[model samples]
Structure formats: C-alpha cells, structure tokens
Target: MSLAERLVRLPDPRRRRGVRHPFVAVLLIAASAVAAGARSYAAIGQWARSAPQQTLARLGARLLTSLNVRIAPSGSTIRRIVSTVCPGGLADLMGEAPTGAPAVAVDGKSARGSRTDTALAAHLLSAVTATGRVVSQLRVPDKTNEISTFTALLAPFDLTGTVVTADALHTQREHAKWLVEVKKAHYLLVVKCNQPNLHAAVRALPWQEVTARRYDRGRGHGRRETRSVRTLTVTGLGLDFPHVVQAVKILRHRTNVKSGKVTRQIVYAITDMTAREASPQFIGRIARSQWGIEAVHHVRDTTFAEDASQIRTGYGPENMATLRNLAINRLREHGHTSIAAGLREMSYEPFTRPLDLLGVAP
Candidate 1:
C-alpha cells in the first residue's frame, strides 16, 4: 500500500462536528511540505495553498466546488491536526526499516527552539541503524531523562543478534544487562569518567607492548586524523557491569594541515563481543557508526532548520521532527547525500517532486 493508504490507520483527533479537511490529507500535505523545504508552519500552509490541484488530489485532498481545484486546509487547521496527532503513531508510520539491522545506535536530541520557562524543550531518544535509518523514537518525559527512556525508545524493535551502541551516559549496568539478557542483543558501550572505576580500569590496561589491532587514517575539512586501536580480553576483570568480554583503547592524533598543529586524545570502549565473534575492526566500525545518529541530528538542524523551528506547542515539535527525518531518509533512499540539494530539487519541481517523495502518483 502507498503511504497515504497506510496513514489512514491513525485515528483522527479532531471532533466530527465541524471538520473540514481530511486528517490523512492534511498530514500528507504537512509531510510533502516538509519534504519540499517548508521550514515553518506558515510555509507549510502556503505550500498547501499553492499546491497543484492534481497533486493535492493524488495526496488525498478532496475536490472543491470547481472541478479543477482542491480544498487546502487553512494554516490553523493544519497546525491543529499536526499538533494533536499522536506522535507515537506517526513515528511508527515514518520509521520503517528493513529486517536484521546488525548495529543500532541510540542517542538523544533536544529541540532547542522549543524551550520555555514552563518546560524544557522536547527531548527525544532515537534508535538508528548504521545506514542512517531511524528505527524508532520516544519522547523523554518531563522531569526524566534519556537514561530512563532508553529502553522504551528501543523496546519496539526486534534486536536479537543486533549490536546496540550508545554514549557513556547510557552505560548503566541495568541497561547493559537488559540488552544482553532480555533483548538477546550485544552491547558496545563507551566508558567515560561517569563510571569512575570502569574508566580507571580500562585506562590502566597495559598497552605500550600491545600491537595496534586497528588503524585508520582520514582527512576531511582541512584536518587530518589518525586512529590506533588496541583490544584486551577482560573476562575475569571482575568489572561492576554485567557480562564481560573485551575492552578497547584508542589513541587519536589530529593535525591541522594549514598550521601544522597536532593534538592527541584517548578514548575507551567496552563490548560483549569475544575475540572470535567480533574482531577489533568490527568493533571499530560499530564504534564509528555510533556517530551516524549524530550526523542525522546535524542534518535536521542545519539542512531542515529543525533547531530553528518554533513549533513548541503540544506534539507539534516532535511531529515536525519526525517529518524532517522522514525527508532526510527519503532523500537518502533516492540516492541524494546532500539534503540541501535534495530540498532544492524537490522545491524546483514542487508539483511532482514532493508527490514522488510521498509515494503519491499525479
């Protein structure tokens, strides 16, 4: 079924007394507008007003009194529908990934523009695959944090045999145990000063004599970085966390090509993979893939203007964010790496371009 057909499963939140626009149609317009570079609610409304009748019709909009025209929902109507629709339902609809995601990264992003004195911004915890597919997302509840919401964010997916990676903040003993025992998944967690003992032990491993298990060098944005990694089996290390296998230490040297200034840094990571199961190279790749979610956040904030969006009311901010990610994932699926360029192309041919993205025919 097409995306429009699938969206009809969501229950409409509005009253039937005086409803004008179809809920699914309004959602389609909102999604298509975001895909076409509509940065704000006003822009979304404007896009609806200017959309071609055939495009609107294909997206489920109704016929108007004139046969050649379609009724576009007003800005307020679109805002209300979008802000009231269940974010969880929309997230499910938008987050469709293929089976067998080997490595998944969990991270959190706060909508900075939604901050107010009455409440903090909308903070959402998301699970994304190594290839930039957002599998799921959940809102971190008020007065709570991502640590408390991590399990909820990842609970819906079948994670058996998948390697889940997260930043140090999510490296709790309970989380590690749950991922291993409950989900039947492996975990690669970074160890920072947050867990003092584990960090100290990982730092204390004898490494001068150990050969480099992995080496990678790359240059980007006028800077060059070289990474050397070594691994140690910590099965009997008596660590505080549950399940033990390997510990990793990495040294990074970064240099500025123009100024010839060099800087060095160290990082530590832990994983449940044994030497036979996952080599140092696999661990390093999964470690690097953890930043894929960060890249998605950067794209949302920079290309989609997510951080600048001021839709702070109700579910509006998070729903808008889901649409933004939908656009990014759509563009990536269509073989566009540059989201800015994709937006321009979609907008240049607004009538058919956005519909093509929405899986609608015109």
Candidate 2:
C-alpha cells in the first residue's frame, strides 16, 4: 500500500552476498532524501545520517555500524545502489497517471552538466500529464535524437482515447499512423518544416472561414499575450496526413510590457479528433497543456539544479533524474507550490517528515 512496498517489488541488481543495508531500505532512503531536497549522493547520505532514530526506523534502515548502533548506508553505497537499479522499473513504479482521457505532453531535455567536450549531454524524453505529473521518461541514445526516442517513450502506456501532444520534431506520418492505428490514441502534433507538405497544406487552409474559433488573452511574467485558434474539419482539405480529421492554426501575439516590443507567430497542428470531438475551446486548452512537460523540465533544472550537477558516471545521471521526478511529483501532490520552499521545510530538524511522505513503515 505504501511506496516502500511498491519499491520492494523491484528486483535488486546487486550481488547476493555481502550486502549490509537492505536494498529496499537503501532505495527508499535515497528517494526520501531526494524528496527532502538532497541533490547528490553526499547530501543523501548526510540526510540519512542526520535523521532521527525514529525516522530511520520508519524507513527500515536498521543497518548496524562497528559502534553497535543502527545506521544508514554510506554515501558510496547509496550511489552504487541507485546507479545500478533498473531505471525503467523505477519510473514505471513512480509514474502513473489517473484514469480517463489524460492529456499527455511529450518533450525532451538535455542535462547540461552531463555533457563533455567529446560527447553530447544526456538527452531524456518525458511524457508529462496536464496536471504536471510525469507519466514516463526515457533517455535518448547517444547516437540518436528525440524523434528516434519518442515512440519508445510512449510505448509503455496504454494510451486508448488519450491525447498525446508533441512538438514539431515528432510530426512524422509514421508517428501519426502508429499513434492512431497501433496505440488507438489521438495525437495533436505540431506541424513545421519537419513535415513540409503537411505544414504547407495546413497553412494554406482557409482558416478565416473556419466555423470554430477560440481566442484568449493573458498577462504574466512581464508580458501580455493573445492567442487565437482556428479549427477546420480536414475531411475536405485533400491533405495527405495520416488519420487527420482536423487542422488547427494558432496565432500568438506577444508584447513585452517593459520594452513595449511586440512579436507574433503562427503554429500549425493536425489532430485525429474531428471538429466535433475537439471543440475550439478544448483545442485551446489541450494546446496549452502541451507545455506541461516543459514545466517539469524547468523545475528539475532551476529548483533541483540538475543542469549543474556533475554526476555522469554509469546509470547515475538517469537514476538521479528519476528520483528528481519522483520528488517533484510528491511535492506537488502535497500542495507545495514552490519546490525550493518544500525542500527547506522538509530539511528542517526531525527529518521524519520526508519518511512520512515516502510512506515509510515504522
């Protein structure tokens, strides 16, 4: 029923002998420390060591040291265990969306700190729900890009009736066909130069004559922006896009309140849903939800300082990223608006709060 119970179900990747700390306890402790704002192995170990005996007991951390006292795993041990644990299994356990037609926004991010002069940074593709929950995440291979990894990122979920949104990079006909035919899901994919014919066709539509339209205006972060969306039934458009039933064009006009500078851009997209299935208003909301993945990535970079971390060794980067996602989701679920503030509160004395969040057992 608790997170630790679910975590204990994962197979330990370590050897059978000479293990002091229970593998489940080590994993639970690491995840709890990360949720409490420990950004690195050293910080995680420090948090474990500084935890009160009651908190450690709740986390199932009863490993005894030479001094004949129960203790947490050392920094090196925590690092090794995390690095070797199965990332996909961990993600599958931590990432689960609520039932219904959830809006899934897929996006990719590169960890700047993991890059070297000779090698590119670790690129990860993530599927995030509209409510800012991570549904899944997978690392793109060193030899490939997001487009190549997009389908795999989506393969784990049973996406029936779900709306999966992605940027222009994943607007290929193959992706559309796969989503519609194989997954039985709908797609709201951005059209751009990547799909030249599809882009031109959607752009050339008589959007002004479309019967369905929606407009919205908002001010935030020192800028005022207006968005106008036009939707047209694609049945008569004579476009060759796969399973396309509607085409959309969104025009955004922005003005910087501080600089008085103005800019405008138009975005095109094709969706499997008909004009009736996805009204103009619903389209507008779903389009905005496409940025949810960006919000998740932004928090990891800014709040957790993920881009500044120097952890690049063996599964370390991906493993750390998984824990960071879990932490962010937990904080948001617990009604913490600001991740940094949540970390500070959890990091205060008597560290039992983190254990409580982790559903640790007494």
Candidate 3:
C-alpha cells in the first residue's frame, strides 16, 4: 500500500465537531511542503493556499473544495494531533530489515529557541538506523536525565536480533543490563569520564603496555595516518556497576601534510559483549557506526532546515519534525540518490501519487 494509505490507517485522536478522518490530505500537504522547501507552517500554509484545489485533488479528498483553496487549519491544530500519537506507533510503520543485526543508535538533540519565555530547549531523544532512518523519538521532560528517556523509548520495540549503540551519556549499568537481560539485545556503548571507575580502569590498563600496531600515510600537501587497534579482554576492573563484560581502548593517530603535523586520539568503550561473543574489529565497527546519529542530525537540520524552523507552541514543532523524518525515510526507501534532490523533485510536482515517488506503477 501507499505511504498515504498507511498513514491514514493510524488511529485518530480528535473528537471535535470539525474533526476529519485521518485523510492523506494533510500528510500529502505536509510532504509536498517539505519537498518544496517549506520548512515552516506559514510557508506551507502559503503553498497550500496557492493551489488548494490541485493539492486536495491529489490527496483524493478536498478540505477546501471552493475557490480551489480551502482555509488551512492553524498550525497549533497540526501539532496537537502529532503529539497525541505514540512515537512507537510511527516507528513500527517504518518497518524493519529482514537480515543481519539491525543497527539501532539512540541519541538526543535540543531544539534550541523553541520556547519563547525561557531559554529552555526541547530535548528530543531519537532512535535511528545506520542509514539515517529515524525509527522513533521521544520528548523528555526538562531536568530529567537521558537514562530516564532511554528506557521508555526502548520499551516498545523488539531489540532482539538488533545491535543497539549509544554514547557515554546512555552508558549506565542499568541501561546495559536492561538491553541484555530484559530485551535480549547486544549493546555497544562508549565509556567516558562520567563513569569514573570504568574510565579510570580503561585508562590505567597497560594499554601501550600491550602490543599494538600503528599505520600512517601522506596525501596532497598533507600527511595521512591510521592505527590498527587490538584489545585483550581484561577482568577485575573493580567496576561498581554490573553487566560490564569487558573494557576496550581504541588508539587512533593522524598526520597533516601542508605542515608536518602529528596528532593522536584515544577512545575507550565498554560493552556487555565479551571477546568470545564479539571481536575487536566488530567492536570497532559498532563504535564507529554510533555516529550515525550525527549524520541523521546533520540531514535533519541542514538538508531539512529543522533547526531554522520557527515552529513553536502546541504540537507544531514535534509534528513537523516527524513529517521531516517521514519524508526522509520515504526518499531513502525509494533508493533516491540524493535526499535534497528527491525533496526538490517532489516539490515541483504532485505528492499524492505515491507510486511515482516509489517508482512503482499505479
């Protein structure tokens, strides 16, 4: 079925008199606006007002049948509907991969300046895939730790057969134990200053004392460098927390060309998976892929102009963010060579035609 159809199938939370079915019209409007570069409500409203009839017809329904343009609802209405639904429901709609360990990365982003009265930002926790698909998201109450948000965000999904990765902020003992003991999923989390004992042990270990390999090279007006990392499973680190199967120290080196410059970067990671369960190379790759959240954030903020959005109040901000994610995932699923290019193409034409976007026949 089409994305529009699937979206329409989502349960509606409105009980007001003017409430309409969860028609694809609004979703189509939102998607087209996103594609055409309408990042804010006013811009989308303007786009909808410009060609009301055409847009409505494309959605297979008409909100404002008269004058070919109907009055669009206030942005507040949109936001309210978005916030009512559970984000996990939307995640399930994105589907899943058939094979291989599903790489799931959890990270948080702050919508700075989203609130008017105070400087308090909206902290959003998102679960995304390696290819930058946002599976789900949650809005944490201000003053709460990400650990509190992490468990709730993970509750709805099946972590089995999945490899969950997160940064040091989410590397709590309980978090690791929950993912393994409760969810039966493997976890790859970074160990940083926050975990004092774990951090000190990872640091105090005879790291350089262990045999390691270093690789380096040079390029245009600059030099290049690489370090082949290896790790030996060590026990008795005296960690106060539980479920820490092993600790790993990753050594990295870099060189500059224009000027003969040398730099070294070292990282430490902790995981419940042991050497018998996971190899050093596997750990390295998982740790590296944790940055997928960065790429996802970059695309949402830069390509989609999420940070520049002026949406505030009610559900507008959250709903719009979800729409951007939906648009991104759809474009990626279709094998679009470039998300920016795909969005641009969708903006100039009709959006109700899901088959066209999916490169399928009607």
Which portions of model 3 show Cα errors greater than 4 Å?
A: 20-24, 50-55, 63-101, 209-228, 236-240, 254-263, 348-355, 358-362
lDDT per residue for candidate 1 within 1-362, as digits (tens), equals 87787788999999999987888899999999999999888999999999877788887786666665688888899999889999888887888563598899999999999998898999988888888878777788999889998987777777899999999999899999999999999999999999999898888877776663999898976999998878888788676668868888878899999999999988888888888877878888888779778998989899887888888998998899888888888888899988899999998988789889868766
* Pick by lDDT: 1 or 2, better one: 1
Question: Candidate 2 clashing pairs?
Answer: none
Stretch of 10 with least lDDT, candidate 2: 93-102
- Tens-place lDDT digits, model 3, residues 274-338: 78776776666666567767876777887877877766665556666766776777788778747
> Model 3: how far is 211 from its true place, Å?
5.2
lDDT per model, in order? 0.86, 0.85, 0.67
Which pairs clash in the backbone of model 3?
Answer: 53-68, 79-315, 79-316, 221-257, 221-258, 222-257, 223-256, 223-257
- Indicate whether candidate 2 or candidate 3 has the larger TM-score: 2
- Better candidate number, 2 or 3, judged by lDDT: 2
Name the lDDT value of residue 207 in candidate 1.
70
- Give the number of the best model, judged by lDDT: 1
Residue pairs with backbone overlap in model 1: none
Ranking of all predicted structures according to TM-score, beginning with the best and ending with the worst: 1, 2, 3
Better candidate number, 1 or 3, judged by TM-score: 1
